[model samples]
Target: MAHTIQGKKQLLTRVRRIKGQAEGLERALNAETECLAILQQIAAIRGAVNGLMAEVLEGHIRTHLGAHDISETQRDNDMEAVVAALRSYLK
Candidate 1:
């Protein structure tokens, strides 16, 4: 992700936070927290993951395709792939 080096620190920070969140979830599981609370944690984790994905996707577009080296067809295909990914992820 040399092209994304500028955002690397921010991305790593987000990942570290996610790791902490995951550890907390594990602790909650070990402590047998309420089912509702566990579900909420899971939802929060999912949202964090989705947010990370969006940032990476944004970087990919701006760094790779933005260089204008690829053909229009290739660019369109890449965008379609991004859309497909989002669709599956949201489902």
Candidate 2:
């Protein structure tokens, strides 16, 4: 998609950060870290993942829905609303 064309590096950096978070969780598990701390790390990883999902969803709305110039601004506005709702829901 156009996202990869323009946002490849951006997306890759996010994914790599997520990978690091996952590895941190694994290390915590292996090292017998406290359960509470481990859960916090998992929560952080989940947040990062949710953030990535939002970015992809936004891109999809812009790329596909925005393509039909009819109501492009409305679609953009709707996408923003959806993103805000998602953040609230995810939280």
Candidate 3:
């Protein structure tokens, strides 16, 4: 199913922010930042990415899957895809 353009834009913004965080990390590393500080930054970035994934997954499940016209096969596939994504990220 196609997602709304607005939803796509939101996800894109999140991904861009995560990309910026990664670049910031590279800069931190190059500057020889403190180990603890670097670790904290990494953790923060991970959390942000995880949060974004969760949001997208939630939207997919609640919106696309909830549509009354969706066939059982498509629903199952979408649900499975969400589960797989969640597992990958949680790991």
User: Which predicted model would earn the best TM-score?
Assistant: 3
Give candidate 3's error at residue 80 in angstroms.
2.2
Task: Return the TM-score for each candidate structure.
Answer: 0.76, 0.73, 0.82
The residue ranges of model 2 lying beyond 4 angstroms of the native Cα positions read 69-91
**Per-residue alpha-carbon lDDT of model 1 for 1-91, expressed as tens digits?**
5646888888999899899889999999999999999999999988898899889888887876686788889888878887898899779
TM-score of 2: 0.73
Computed on alpha carbons, the lDDT of every model, listed in order, comes to 0.86, 0.85, 0.84
Model 1, position 26, has a per-residue lDDT of: 100
- Model 1 residue 86 lDDT score: 80
Q: What is the lDDT of residue 5 in candidate 3?
A: 54
Which residue pairs collide in model 1, if any?
none
Clashing pairs in 3: none
Query: Any runs in candidate 1 off by more than 4 Å, and if so which?
Result: 71-91
What TM-score number comes out for model 1? 0.76
Error of 3 at 15 (Å): 1.4
Better of 2 and 3 by TM-score: 3
